[model samples]
Target: MNITKYVLVLLVMPFLFGCNSDDYQYPDKYLPNYNFSIDIDMSLPLYTPLQFTANPVYIDQAGIGINGIIVMNTGGGYVAYEASCPNQNLDSCSKLAVDGIMAICPCDEAEYNLFNGQAEGKEYPLKPYRIQVTSGTSIRVYN
Candidate 1:
């Protein structure tokens, strides 16, 4: 094609399809507002299970988010997600319960992979927080 036509196409292509857009943006309710990190002690009972799909720790001590945070060790890495369901309206049944390697929304059975916090069979993924390894056996999950 022509040089000018090629240049115009290249410039307009990026805008037509967002080159750096994030395809997995969740709604506001699924995210948390508190800007704080909670230090987890692996020596604790709830956190002792570091397996792939084990019991998740309901850490209410963080004093943030809807209910609190649920930390799960994904075998390779650790992920911390908001305890409440991100897709459903805030309700008593919106709390997510851990079953195997997924976080299940009690209201609609919307499951999310705890490893990457991606909601299974849903458009939006689970709301995720930042996790920093503090030590050999400790990590801090922050909003």
Candidate 2:
């Protein structure tokens, strides 16, 4: 019985730990970093419609460092994505347009889901920023 137990232990040990390979692979960086801040006042006509699953709003103000930023209400919470193409460099044609839940890039016609920033049929996703509700009347988007 002891010999049988030892053989069982030896079999289990390899399966328990397996191989420890430190080498791992990751995808390459494909987007530029642009600093920006956006303040949403719900009382403002421009942002009033953003409650949940509504049309996304494109914000263009002095403090938004790049061309602009896109803000949307995902029906659960708020999400914001950089209004630029992740697969391509910044250019006039690379700016994104929102149609329903997707952000479309004019240059390549690549589409990314606004809720999670995952591109459709592509490995690269949209560059995302951080957003939080400051109050019942306001939201802040920053990177």
Candidate 3:
């Protein structure tokens, strides 16, 4: 019975200690959660720029996202990110502006790559949204 108990403990010890508790914490910890779903029609005049590669559009409609959503056409596919800077709370300068394929935070000048939402030497990456290509001319972004 003692030998069996030892074997059981050995098996469970790895299960308990092998997992990293910090894994539960997300990289984008500063941004608050918001529930929203928005669809963009690529054929529309406002969204027509997204049909080309590296053309990013900022949809600043109220309640669309934390600040808003920055939708980009990477040529490979459509990518959407929360326009709020990930490294800090939402502020006047937290809104990201499209600078080519990079989103620049006006406050800190932190640049995040639109292709992957990563900022160089920054701990947090831009918050991403789920993108569904409903058709050749439409996409749904949700979070």
Sorted by TM-score, highest first, which candidate order results? 3, 2, 1
lDDT of 2 by residue, 2-77 (tens): 9999999999998778756532222336555667677789788989878657568888676573557888888888
lDDT of 3: 0.88
Error of 3 at 11 (Å): 8.8
- Any residue pairs clashing in model 2, and if so which? none
Model 3 lDDT at residue 2:
100
Locate the minimum summed-lDDT window of 10 residues in model 2: 21-30
Q: lDDT per residue, candidate 1, 1-143, as tens digits? A: 69999999999998888855335344685554667778877866667774434556767764756678788876667878888887777788988887877888899988887777787577667777777888877888886
Best by lDDT: 3
Could you tell me how far off, in angstroms, the CA of residue 23 lies in candidate 1 after the best superposition?
Answer: 14
Instruction: Decide which is better by TM-score, 2 or 3.
Output: 3
Residue 121 lDDT in model 2?
82
lDDT of 1 at 47: 73
What is the TM-score (0 to 1) of candidate 3? Answer: 0.81
How do the predictions measure up, each by TM-score? 0.72, 0.73, 0.81
Clashes of 2: 0
